[model samples]
Target: MEIRALVFDVFGTVVDWRSGVAREVRRQLPGVDAEAFADAWRGRYVPSMDRVRRGEQPWTSLDDLHRASLDELLAEFGVPGVPADARAELVLAWHRLTPWPDSVAGLTRLKERYVIASLSNGNVALLVDMAKHGGLPWDTVLSAELFGHYKPDPEVYDGAARLLGLPPERVLMVAAHTSDLAAARARGLRTAYVHRPAEHGPAATPPPGADPEADVSVASLTELATRLSA
Candidate 1:
């Protein structure tokens, strides 16, 4: 099927989320071990999501999960003296995630030819804030909050298709993560991989053999846009 709209995964896909988070954390705490704190905080992400998925806790957005994780990570890292108000300040960090350098320009190229939206696990509010902060230029934002499900869940993928008034095959899901593309591919959405190798850090490694499975793989959004625009 021909691809039309390009839907993106925000965190770690369009943006180097870990790097951005680490930068923010570092900026907020001068001369601190920012990278260590970034890794520590991100490492808590999945288990927290699992808690929500398993019904151990009520539905929570990514922002709330970040806050919960922050409290644990700060305590573990022995970061001293963050007031309650300061805690609220840190929780909003996700709102200002920085975009990958190629992101805005690449999305602009693709947008000239195709509709672009974010099909991410982030809630609409968070995605909106990030878009505004980063000048992401999305035609619309499609988050898991709309379907109350997260990525790798079929509903979120299908929900985006339904919301866009398109069939599964006509929409393309672009991301740096293979598992994300696998989920989209399983549901008939075309899959594209735009590499964000530094996503996990300098030593980050790509998942073995997953790139070939993508309809196309490129090093950056600009490259993806070039191919799609061709």
Candidate 2:
């Protein structure tokens, strides 16, 4: 099927989550190893969601999970003097992520050829705030919060296709993470991989330039747009 829609994984793909989180952490905790702190916080992400997926916890938004995880991370790091209001505001740092240099231009081009939307584990409100802050040009914001299921879950992928009124094959899932692309492919959506070596940090390794598994793979979203538009 010809692709009619492009659904993106926002964190680390469209936006620089690592740098953004690290920056916020440095601002909030002056003496902290900001990068390490950012990685540790992000490291808890999957486990927190896994609890929900495994039915150990009730359905919850990513924002709520972030807060829950943040409480633990702060305690572990032994950070000092953060009041309740400040803690709450700090958790909203996810809302202030900055977009990659090529993100807006690439998405704008792709938007002309396809219905562009975010298919992320992020809550709808979080995605909305990030979009506004980063100038992301999504046609719609689709989130796991909407379906009560997170990415790598069949429900989230199928739910996005359903909401767009398109068959799974007609919606391309674009992500920097291999597991996300793999999950979308399993749900019958075409897959495009974007390389984001710096997602974790300067030492983070990049994924292969080409993958037999991915229908398409590129160094950046700009390249993805160029190929898709060809």
Candidate 3:
């Protein structure tokens, strides 16, 4: 089936989360290794979401989860005495993430040909703020918060298609992570893997190139647009 809408995974796929979080961490906590701190915080993302996914906890917004992780990380990193306001500001770092170089222009081009929206684990408010901050031209924002389930869960993928009023196959799930794409595929959505080698940072091992199971794999969103004839 031809894809009519493209729903994106936001954090590592569209935005440079590591750099943005590190920048905020550097500013907020002068003495800490900002990059490492950023990595540590992101490292907790899946586990935190897994809690809610497993029904171990009720639905919690990504922002609240991030805050909870941040508090634990602060103490783990031996950076105590951070005021409540400061912690809150740090949690907002996810909202201020910068887009990758090809993100805006490529998404703009794709938007000209297809409906482009975000289908992310991040809550709707955070997605909106990041879009505004980065000048991302999404047609609409769809998030796990809306479905009360995170990526890798069928509800989020199925919910995106339902909300778009398109069949699962008519929507392409675009992401940097194969796990996300795989889950989308399981729910009958087409998959596109957009390589993001620098998502974790330069020193970290890169994600595998071109997922074998994806309908398409491209180096950047521009490439994806080209491949999709957008």
Candidate 4:
């Protein structure tokens, strides 16, 4: 089936989360190792969401989860005395993430050809703020918060398709993570893997190559736009 809509993963796929978070950390906690702190905070993301997925907690917004993780990290990193206002501002770091170089231009091109939207684990408010901050021209935003389930769960993939009023196969799920794409594929969505080698920072190992199961794989969103003739 021809894809009629493209739903993108936000964090590391569209925005450079590690660098953005590190930048915020550096500003907020002068003596801290910003990069390590950023990595540690992000490292808690999946596990925190997993708690909700497993019914261990009721639906909690990504912002709340991020704040919770930040609180824990402050103590863990020996900076437990951070003022509440400062901590709240730090949690907003995710809302002000910087987009990758190709993100806005590539998405703009894709938007000209198909319905383009965000399908992310981040809450709608966070996604909206990020879009405004980065000048991302999404036709709309869809998020796990809407479905009360995170990526890798069928609900998020299926919910996006349902909300778009398209059959699963008529929507392409774009992401930097194979696990996310694979889950989307399992729910009958087409998949594109966009490589983000610097997502976890330069020292982290990048994806070795394209995902064998992805319908398309490319080095950037611009390449994805080209592959789809957007």
**lDDT of all the models against the reference?**
0.85, 0.90, 0.95, 0.94
The collision pairs in model 4 are none
Q: For model 2, what is the C-alpha lDDT against the true structure?
A: 0.90
Q: Write the per-residue lDDT of candidate 3 for residues 1-230, one digit (tens) a residue.
A: 77899999999999999999999899889999999999999999999999999999999999999999999999999998999988988999999999999999899999999999999999999999999999999999999999989988999999999999999999999999999999999999999999999998899999999999999999999998888887
TM-score winner between candidates 1 and 3: 3
Which window of 10 residues has the lowest lDDT sum in candidate 4? Answer: 200-209
List residue ranges in candidate 2 displaced over 4 A: none
Poorest 10 consecutive residues of model 2 by lDDT? 203-212
* Alpha-carbon RMSD, candidate 2: 1.1
Superposition-based RMSD of candidate 3 using all C-alpha atoms, in angstroms: 0.6
lDDT of 1 at 91: 70
Tens digits of per-residue lDDT for model 4, 1-230: 88999999999999999989999899999999999999999999999999999999999999999999999999999996799988988999999999999999999999999999999999999999999999999999999999989888999999999999999999999999999998999999999998888888889887746888999999999999999998
Return the TM-score for each candidate structure.
0.94, 0.97, 0.99, 0.99
Error of 4 at 149 (Å): 1.1
Steric clash pairs (candidate 2) = none
- Per candidate, the number of residue pairs that clash is 0, 0, 0, 0
Residue 111, candidate 1: alpha-carbon lDDT: 92
For model 1, what is the C-alpha lDDT against the true structure? Answer: 0.85
